[model samples]
Target chain A: MKISAKEVQNVAELARLELDEALTAKLADQIGSILNYVDTLKKVDTTGVPPTNHALSLSNAFREDVVVPSPGTDKALANAPLKENGCFVVPKIVG
Target chain B: MTLYNLSIHDAAERLRKKEISSRELTLSVLERIAKTDTKVKAYITLNEDQALAQADQADQAISKGIARPLTGIPLSIKDLICTQGLLTTCASKILENFVPTYDATVIEKLKAQGAVILGKVNMDEFAMGSTTEHSGFKITANPWNLDHTPGGSSGGSAASVAADMCLGSLGSDTGGSIRQPASHCSVVGLKPTYGRVSRYGLVAFASSLDQIGPLTKNVKDCALMMNAIAGYDPKDSTSVNECVPDFTATLTQSIKGKKIGIPREYFSTEGIDPDVKNSIDQALDTLKSLGAQCVDISLPHTPYAVAAYYVIAPSEASSNLARFDGVKYGIRDMEQTELVDMYKKSRSRGFGLEVQRRIIIGTYALSSGYYDAYYKKASQVRTLIIRDFKAAFESCDILISPVSPSPASIIGQHSEDPLKMYLSDIFTISANMAGIPGLSVPCGFNQMGLPVGLHLMGRHFDEATLLNVAHCFESATDFHTKRPSL
Candidate 1:
């Protein structure tokens, strides 16, 4: 549970976040304390217990494949920071 | 009394009798908001023109003898719930100006009832923190004491009701978000069972734990709001297909033989304010005098609730928030030279510190080496916590406890310590972890004159019993009648 700065950097990179040395060090301590506290779960016996992702027991919901009208392209793209002819514009990907 | 001070029950009755025009009520509340919002900062966006237009429409409907139950009732919406064409910021800068093209399912329901939406209220960034101080916009103050917080992330909604700015408001509780704020503000707040209310169009937090309910001046208004908002929705898969009951049908029912469970663990927990403990003890006595049996119950896994919730909620948040990556909508970093860099920079800058911290924790928990140890372990522990409730409910009609360990803390009290802030949710999180309905009703006040809340949690989809118990208590005491003078 000892979260190192390197570990914070690794996780931040995976999460697509750029953390400075100061924030990374701070997070290292914060996350370390949190994880250390959660380590108490290790004491519980769960030899054959199934994990519960949701509180209720629900099965896969099915629906017809029929098409329905949605917010048109214009409205859908309204909040985009940058947009092209009709699509969202992002930084260059292929180099 | 000013129209702003009228409870939804009384206001709706007066509206039906033509004793008050919807426009008059709307204008009065608007005027009050204009006067007091500077000190409370409860609202994020106030729709004066739109609200007046809606009120006018409601008046026209009344003239035509077709006014709905919520007709002309002005209510505040937590910014996390989508309102078509209105900015729903979730108090995060990332979605600072973002407006949804469509309404949340609950908004659609309220609109159907001819309800007037006053505006979106502030909350913690992405509903991440307990105090509204984490808002990227501004902090909401406790109406009772300006120096203290109106417990959050639904702080603004609770404050709006307590300050008479709105008759009722909608807030989503992921952990203790709704109930805690309602407790601090001394209003009635309920977090309906997961799946009891649809989550469609609610800005996703922890999907499994998030449930939208009402914060109102009294238990009757809470039930009325529930009657309007609680039901099945085909749009949300998790919404229960079971029949929705009339929540108001049994509010006046007697609790002659009702079994009220007192979890010993909740009372014995460290850091429980002595004032809170005293209030809860008095509340139990009040219930006992009302002919209810208070039985000792144990949720043995209670200590693990906060730990399990932090992991499960943040893990789900990491996946849900991954959608905000400088694309489609929300803020985007335009200066980045590359796509990957843009994603990193946009997220790093767009999200607040607490939000980023959760995302980081979630990411680390779900990462390759740690998934089994953290995420999986947390989910398993969540099962145990749920089982603990299932067993406790077997002997109790409803469980009563303190909504919070203490009243609202000072505005900046826990901002520096993340773990300390997380621990404040002890009393309220288990309900969410178990996905049951929990209600917070004004019980008493601390020495500082800050309101304390009595917590009542019930079986899944059993909000009626919880509301009945709260209504009975409110009838027996004047706690719910005490309002903060702004």
Candidate 2:
């Protein structure tokens, strides 16, 4: 249950976060203590208990597929940090 | 009473009677904000000119005899809910300048009711922290005492209502965000049933746990706001199709013969401030005197609620926040050449320390080998917690407890320790975990003159019962009427 600095680094990488050594060490220690506290759940026997992902139990909400007016390209890209030619501009994915 | 300090119902009556104009009311509120918001820091963005224009429209509607309950009311909105063409920062640097092209379903509903929006208020960045100190913009102080926190992440909403900057406000609660701040600031806050209000425009936190509700000066005003906002919406699949009742119609109903459950675990929980306990005990006596029966009940899984919430909320947040990568919306890093590098750099630079910590914790919990030990186990515990509430509700009409273990803490008291801050939400988290309606009403003041909130929780979609009980308490007490000296 003790999270090491290296594991913190690995998790940050997986989470796409760039944490410096100090934050990584601090997070490892903090997350380790929190997990240790959360380990109390292990004491509660949850045998045969179905995990609840949501509080309300509802079936799949399906609606008929139909063409709906979109917000339009201009409105959709209004909040885009970088955009060009009615499209979102992003860094090159393929060299 | 000053026009700015009038409750929604009172102001509505005045506006309808032609005793006060909406423009006058809005001007009074704007003047109040201009005077006090510097010290309280409740608002992040003030909509002065727009509010005046809306007030004029409201006055026109009033003159035409078509005014609604909120027709001329000026209210602040928590920054997370999208406001069309308005700055909707979730109090984060990532979306500092993000403006929504469309209103959130709740915002649209409020606008349709002629509610004049004052502006977007500050909150914890991403609604992640219990205190507004984590806001990327600024920290909102508790109106009662400038040195203390207005319990968050709805701190700004509660403080604005308590400080008379606005008549009422809309706040989203993922855990105890709404109720806790309402408690600390001695205002009224209600977190409706998970599906009771549409979440279409709310910036996703923990999607399953997040809900939009109202914070107001009194319980009836809270009910009025609920009547305006709660209902089904085709836009949000999670919004329930249940009938939205007249939330204010049941406010005057007597609590006689109502079965109030006193959770034994909550009373015995460690670290509950003595002053808070004393206030709750006195409040219970008042309820008992009003002909209500207090029953002893057990929610044995109460201790594990904070633990389960940490895992589940963070896990959901990590996944939901993935959309913030440098491309579609929010800030992007232009210095990085590679796509992945830009994502990493932008996210790291955009997010605050607490956000990064949660993302890491969530990623680690959901990681391959740790999934069973963390996320699954937490989900199973959530089931147990839900079962506890279901059984407790069967025996009692409502559950009453302290909103928070203590009153608002001094600012920076828990800033150094994240776990300590998380534990402050212990009492309030279970209501969110169970997805039931929870309310906070001003019960009494602590020894330091800080307000203490009486927590009332009810069955699923049973906000009426909670409102009735809170209204009854307000009728019998003057706590809600005691304004903080700014």
Candidate 3:
């Protein structure tokens, strides 16, 4: 299926990526080509096969709940570009 | 001995005999890196002071008679591994200055074993590309031929070891990140079965397919790394709890009657280079001479690997990488008038174009209108690919093939076409899809004098068997001894 310019913009918006007008057209062409190429999966018969979300056969490996003071709030926030009041600050979501 | 050339086994042995201090060895590798990395561009970050301090402590430990498999072995870590107080960028602009607060589980184990941390090696951004060209910082050139690309996203790890810039390095193999480079660079690289190593601090590219293993110069060193890093990790919910065998213990076993599989599917016409085919044939001949029962088998769904991988890996990556939004870690723009704008601006400014393309494509695939048609359908095909291996393995002890379809391509050959770039992982991704063990050992060099990696695959969590097969092959061949002409 051809990816419309509108769809490209939607995906770009959803992915939170900034795109110039040139890039938007290039992305449309590239993604359009990719989608066209990837359509080969449509030919395979996978009626009885169960989808594989996890590659390993095992399940339910969990760490016990225990308090560990590691990479505390300060350390976690250290990589953030902007912060305020011990929290990552961002632009207003609500008007 | 050059620190870059010494295997972990040899380094540890020499250190125990007091032949060389860890400080001396660490400095040697550091100096080697200093001299060559200007052209190779293998290392992204080097901790000279910290490395020397660790080496001194390891020397002290050895002086006091402390013993461990990795002690006093200075190894490079792939940039993907988290190093506390050091940048772990995944070689992407997105997390350019993001220093992880905690060490990856492998890092912790290496430190505990007294292994010297030489530095972090470069790779394709987020382990997404087969060639290191996808990296945002700079393309890592192959040690064998600077004009050719180093296969990646573990290209730096493989190239560094190949050039003797570092003795060994840890690399994640979601789809041949470790093995392909090892093939291109003529080194030994292993991808332990999925869940063989913990993923707690690894910036997850794909949860299911990702497994961290060492890229080393020889099989014995790969075994040493497998032993230390192959245990169950409670931190990662998917970490397998099966017992990790002392992988190095079976190094001397014979390979007389092991049923080695040669899948005709691999040799079939998907553009297998003649040199690779010759090397694989030579490899099979050597194994046959050593008493291996070779048989033909089929993994008919082999063509589906790239398609399924692109869908599943990117789908998972889209989810895993979502946490990198500027708000929590890395770069976040404050000047945005709205929160959504802040996120878009940060990610757009941070991630490279290829990474953005993937994130966009992944988000599109997993979106509400297309989830069932794309992500869900691709996943079902992934199951068929897994079953193909499962059936084939039942008829053979281990399967062997070429690590890559072609030898290392020249830099910028396929960097422009993402689909073409993704096909480079064709021969290796199926192993990851099946969550089985995969290894790449230098088989021979092409007419270009570049290397060709022979791939050995085994059943799930069967690194021991794979190592035994590799050891058997190495004992019979001198490919491991061949290094780039520096």
lDDT of each prediction vs. the true structure?
0.94, 0.93, 0.87
DockQ of predictions, in order shown: 0.85, 0.86, 0.76
Candidate 3 local lDDT, B97-200, one digit each (tens):
88888899999999999888888889999888888988879889999999998888899999999999878889999999999998999989999888878888
Error of 1 at B469 (Å): 0.6
Classify candidate 1 by CAPRI docking class: high
How should the candidates be ordered by DockQ, best one leading? 2, 1, 3
After superposition, the stretches of candidate 2 with alpha carbons farther than 4 Å from their true spots are none
Cα error, residue B72 of model 2, in Å, equals: 1.1
Question: What overall lDDT, based on C-alpha atoms, would model 2 receive against the true structure?
Answer: 0.93
Give the 10-residue window scoring lowest on summed lDDT in candidate 1 chain B.
B328-337
> Across residues B1-486, which tens digit of lDDT does each residue of candidate 2 receive?
489999999999999999999999999999999999999999999888888999999999999999999998999999999999899989989888888999999999989989899999999999999889999999999999999999899999999999999999999999999999999999999999999999999999899899999999999999999999999998999999999999989999999999999999999999999999999999999999988999999999998999999999999999999988978888888899888789999999899989988988888889999899999999999999999999999999999999999899899999889999998898899988889999999999999999999999999999999999999989999998899998
Off by over 4 Å in 3: A62-70, B1-3
Return the clash pairs for model 3, or none. Answer: none
- For every model shown, the clashing-pair count is 0, 0, 0
DockQ, cand. 1: 0.85
What TM-score does model 3 achieve against the real structure? 0.98
Per-residue lDDT of candidate 1, residues B278-395 (tens digit): 9999999999999999999999999889999999999999999999998978888888889899999998988999999999999999999899998999899999999999999899
